[model samples]
Target: MEQLIQAIILGIIEGLTEFLPVSSTGHLILAGEWLGFVGESSKTFKIVIQLGAVLAVLVLYWSRFVSLAKDMLAWRFFRKGHLDALHIALALLPAVVLGFLLHGLIKQHLFGPEPVLYSLVAGGILMIIAERTKRRVTAEEMDDLSYRQALGIGCFQCLALWPGFSRSGSTISGGLLLGTSQKAAAEFTFIISVPIMLGASLLDLYESRDVLSSSDLPVFLVGLAASFIVAMLAVVTFINLIKRLRLTWFALYRFVLAAVFYFFVLM
Candidate 1:
């Protein structure tokens, strides 16, 4: 019962932070550390439950995904003002290659609170700097993103390899630096996240299969369910928030959270 409750709590944390500029992995590591849930199996559980958040994206963007699929099948790469499959593929390639090369190193060294703390602070500063240095909004819509812009965003995503430097945060900041509108940047961040997270979750699950047990099935299910429900809400709310608010608010939150972690967890 206690374990199940812990799973639910972590699931909520995961859902709330996963899509936001605040790093979900960073939150999870801090939460797990404080809650006494840090372990190999727990790490695997975190990875597995993120699939629920991924599903939220699929549910919300089902139509877009369907359109993209159809466009690919028909080879109508540029029929209308929509992003082609090539754009997404190119955006994803950098992360795929870099992630493969650094996966082991990151898992071995950086999946802890100390590294996360540093990344949280650095990412927060980067976000603030990006937001303050505003540029003209060139890419006003997701469809307007060029292949070069996509590749650039993908390169920025490489920073997220360091936990606490959020994937969405890095990419959105990248898009902003490249003159993508706030809403467009947020949308693109969410769209590209589907493939990257799904692949990473599957890979983690496969590597950590040995740690999973039949007894942990219920915990996993509960976590997945909770995360899915909450993630749907978080994603929608975040999209709306980005439209009306500045990214600096999230950056401030990250800065404060990093300080709290340093005082409470590190010191």
Candidate 2:
């Protein structure tokens, strides 16, 4: 029962932080440390539960995904469209490659409180600087983004290989720095996340298959369901919030959270 409760809490944390500029993995690591949830099963749980958040994205953007599928079947996806599949692919390429290369090393060494603490602070500073130095918006909409801009964002996403740097934070801030509007960057962050996270979740599940068991099924299910529900709400709220506000707020939150974690959790 206690494990189940921990799962629910972790699920809520995952959903709340997944799409936000604040790092989801960073939060999970810190939360797990505090909750005494460290182990292979906990690690596997964190990765697998991300599927719930991915499902929320799918449900919210079902029509867009369906349109992309139809365009792919008709081979019109390359011509022109709002959700350019090619651009997303371009944006995902760098991270996919780097993630593949660094997967084992990251899991073995960097998936801990110390690395996350430093990364959270450093990423927050970068986000603040990026927002302050943002240029005139050239890509006002996700579809307006050129392949070059998408590639640049992908390159920025490489920074997120560090656990606390945050995939959305790096990509969206990179987009802003590269002249994409905030709303456009946030939408693209959500859209491109489906493939990247789905792929990563699958890889983690497969690699950690030994951690799966009938006894733990309920815990996994409860966590997955909780994350899905919360993520749906979070995604919608974040999109609306980004339309009216800057990402500096999230950066500030990250800075404060890092300090709290360092003093309370790490110390």
Candidate 3:
């Protein structure tokens, strides 16, 4: 009962931040460290429970997803239908490739807090630069985009494979840099995250098969539920916020959080 309770709490934390520009990985690492949930099962729990949040994306955006599929199947969408969905797939390709190629190395060494610490700092700096550039020019919103822009965004996504750097942060920042409106960049970032997260979680499940057992499976399920519920709210909130807010706010938070982790926790 005691262990189960701890697992449940950890699961909730994982779900809530997984999609937000705020680093879910960083929060999970810190949560485990502070709460004494850091154990053999920690990494697997973190990865697999992400399914919960991923489902939230699917559930909340089901209409857009369905429209996308219908349009693509008929091969008629675009001006007639919404094809931003296809662009999302195009954007996810780079992360999928890099994730697969570096599978073993990333899984073995990069999923922990210390690695994320550096990522938080470096990624924060990158966010500052992205924000500055975005501020210089009013981002333009195009109803449709060229494949080249999507591909460029996808390439930027590859930078997110490093544990601490966020897939949302990189892609959103990329969109801003390339002259996409905040809303468009954020929407694309959210859509692109679904596949990237799904692929990673499935891979982790395969790798962690040896450690699975019936006894603790329910904990993973609970965490999934918690994360999904929380992430739905988080995603909606994020979409609404970014339209009027600058990315610098997140950069400031990351810098402060990193410093706290360094002096208070690490020391």
Candidate 4:
């Protein structure tokens, strides 16, 4: 009974942080450390709950996602629609490969409080650097994106493999570096999430096959419910927040988390 309540609380935190560029894995690690959910199965539970948030993105962006597919098929405007989607796919390929290769290590060691602390600080520093550079807003819409640039951004995103670095954070920074508008980068980041989260969840479920079972199904369901609802809300709020707020705020958060982690873990 006690475990169930704790799991629900973790679910709420996972769902809200998963979508924003705030490093869901980092938060989960910190939460797990604080709540004594440091075991292997409990850690995986944090990741598996992301499946729920994945579905939320699927449902919320269904119309646009489908349109991207349909437009790609129609080969409109010389197949720019299809080509752009292909570019996104290309960008995701690196993480797909690296993620599977590092799956076990990431699950066991990367999500630990120590690593997460440093990752938070490093990621925060990178965000500040990216923010200070400049905002060019070169690509107004998806159609304006290029394959070469997409490939470049995709390569840049590979850096997020560290626990607290956040896939969205790396990708959005990639887009910003390549001169994408804030809204466009955010929109693309969210859209790109469908594939990335689906891939990660699938990999996690596969690796955790022996431990996962019907007995634990109820908890997974509850976590899913929490994650999906809060994720949708986070998505809505995050998009609005990105436009109005500066990246420095998130950077500050990372620095603060780093300091907190250092004090708690080292001292």
lDDT (Cα atoms) of all candidates against the true structure:
0.88, 0.88, 0.75, 0.77
Please give the distance, in angstroms, between residue 256's alpha carbon in candidate 4 and its true position after superposition: 0.9
Question: Which tens-of-lDDT digit does each residue in 67-127 have in candidate 3?
Answer: 7777778874444223455576678788898889997787688877788888888877877
lDDT comparison, 2 vs 4, better candidate: 2
Candidate 1 has an lDDT of 0.88
lDDT of 3: 0.75
Error of 2 at 47 (Å): 1.3
Better of 1 and 3 by lDDT: 1
In candidate 3, where is summed lDDT lowest over 10 consecutive residues? 134-143
- Which portions of model 1 show Cα errors greater than 4 Å? none
How close to the true structure is residue 64 of candidate 2, measured as C-alpha lDDT? 83
Q: Residues 4-33, candidate 4, lDDT per residue (tens digit)? A: 777788788877887677798888888877
Once fitted onto the true fold, the runs of candidate 4 whose alpha carbons sit more than 4 angstroms away are 71-78, 81-83
Locate the minimum summed-lDDT window of 10 residues in model 4. Answer: 76-85
Clashes of each: 0, 0, 1, 0
Q: Model 2 over residues 1-267: C-alpha lDDT tens digits?
A: 999999999999999999999999999999999999998888878877888999999999999888888888887757453667788889999999999988889888888899998889888888888889949888998888888889999999888889899988998889989999988888888888898889988898788777677887898899899999999999999999888877788888988998998888777
